[model samples]
Target: MSKDPDLELVKRFKEEGSLESFRALYERYKDKVFSTAFAICGNYAEAADVSQETFFLIYRKIKRFSFKSRFSTWVYRLTVNVAVEKRRSRKEFLALSEIGEEVFEHTGDTPLETLERTERDALLNRSLRHLSPKLRTVIVLRYFQGLSYEEISSILGISMGTVKSRLFRAHRELSPLLQRPPFSAPPGGQEDAWQGN
Candidate 1:
C-alpha cells in the first residue's frame, strides 16, 4: 500500500461496495475531522457529534465528490459546515451564558501560572466570539488549524485574495481586542508590571 492507503480505499469504496474500505477511510480521517469540529465548537461533546455527522455526510455524499480537490479538503469543508450550522442553532444559548456575571480574577504563576494562563485563554476566546462567523472561521483555519492560505481558499471555495483580505481584517479586529486595558501590556510586558515608578 502507498503512504495514504485510505485514498486507495476511498476509490475502492466508490467503485465497489467495500465496507472495509469505507471503514478504513473513516478511521483515517476521524481524528482530523474531530479536531476541526472541536476547534470551531469549543465543546468536546458537541464536536464528537459533529464529527460523527460529518462522516455520515461523507459516506452519503462520497459518490458526488469530484476528485478535483484533495480528500482532506473535502472532508474539512464538510466538518466546517456542520460546525457552523451547530453554532448558529445554539447562538441564543451562548448569548444567555455570556450574560452571566463572572468576575475577572487572575492567579499568579507556579500552580497559579496555569490558572492565569487559563484566564487569559478564556478572555481571548470571549473576544473571538464577538467576531463574525466568517472572520472567526478564517482565524481558526489559519491560526489554529495551520492550513495554508491556498488550502483555506480551496476549502472555502473562495479566491485566495479573499482569504488574505479576511485574514488581514481579522487581525485588525483582534489587535484592538488584545490591546484593551488589562491585556494592553502584551504577552510579556515588564513595563506594565512596574508602572508608576
Candidate 2:
C-alpha cells in the first residue's frame, strides 16, 4: 500500500536521517503550526518560541508517534501543548486582545469600524478569561482559530462529540457576557447606572 506523503517523509527521515525529508515536513506545516500557536498566545514572540520548540520537540519525539492519528493532528496537539505550557509558566499569560492591532489589521475598513472591532475583540478577550481553561481552549480553537470540529477533536485528544459539547457549554457561558448591551458609564455626578433614578 502506498504510504501517505507526510508519513513517507517521516519514514525517510527516520530511515535515512535526511534533512531534506524533515525540511519538507517543516515547510509544509510551519505556517499552520505558527498560526495555531499565535492565535493561542496572542503575541508574536511567544508564538515564535512555541513554533520553534514545537518543531524541535517533534524532531526529537516523532519516532515514538504510533501513527494512530493524522500527522497534522499530532502536530497540532504538540503545538498547542507547548504554547499553553509557555503561557502557564508565566505569571501573566497574555490575553487575546492584549495583542497589537497592527498585527491583525485587515484592509477595507473605516477607522470607526476598526476602533469598534478592536473594542469588541478586547471585550471578548476579557470574557474569555472568566471561562475554565478547557472551555477557553475549545472556544479559541473553534472560533478564534477557525478549526473544525474534527480538527479540534484530534488536537485536544477528545472525541468529536466532546468537542461539540464543550463548545456548546462555552457558548452558553459566554452568551450572557457577550449578549449584554454595550457598557455605558454614568454621566458625571450621576448615580451608578444600576441605581434607579
- Which residue pairs in candidate 1 collide? 109-113
Error of 1 at 33 (Å): 1.9
TM-score for each model: 0.72, 0.73
lDDT per residue as tens, model 1, 1-197: 12443567778888896899888888888877876776677666777899999999988998988677778778889999999899888844232012111222344558677666665665566567556778888888888778889889998889999999999998988887666653344335645321212
The list of candidate 1 runs beyond 4 A from truth reads: 1-6, 90-113, 180-197
- Candidate lDDT scores, in order, read 0.73, 0.77
Error of 1 at 19 (Å): 3.5
Give the worst 10-residue stretch by lDDT in candidate 1.
Answer: 95-104
Scored against the true structure, residue 30 in model 2 reaches a CA lDDT of 89
Candidate 2's residue-wise lDDT over 1-197, tens digit each? Answer: 23555888888887788899999999998877887777677678888899999999989997788877778778889988998898888877665545564456767999998778877765676567657778888887787567789889889988999999999998999887676543533236443422223
Q: After superposition, how far is residue 5 of candidate 2 from its true place, in Å?
A: 6.0
What candidate 2 gets wrong by more than 4 Å, as runs, is 1-5, 180-197
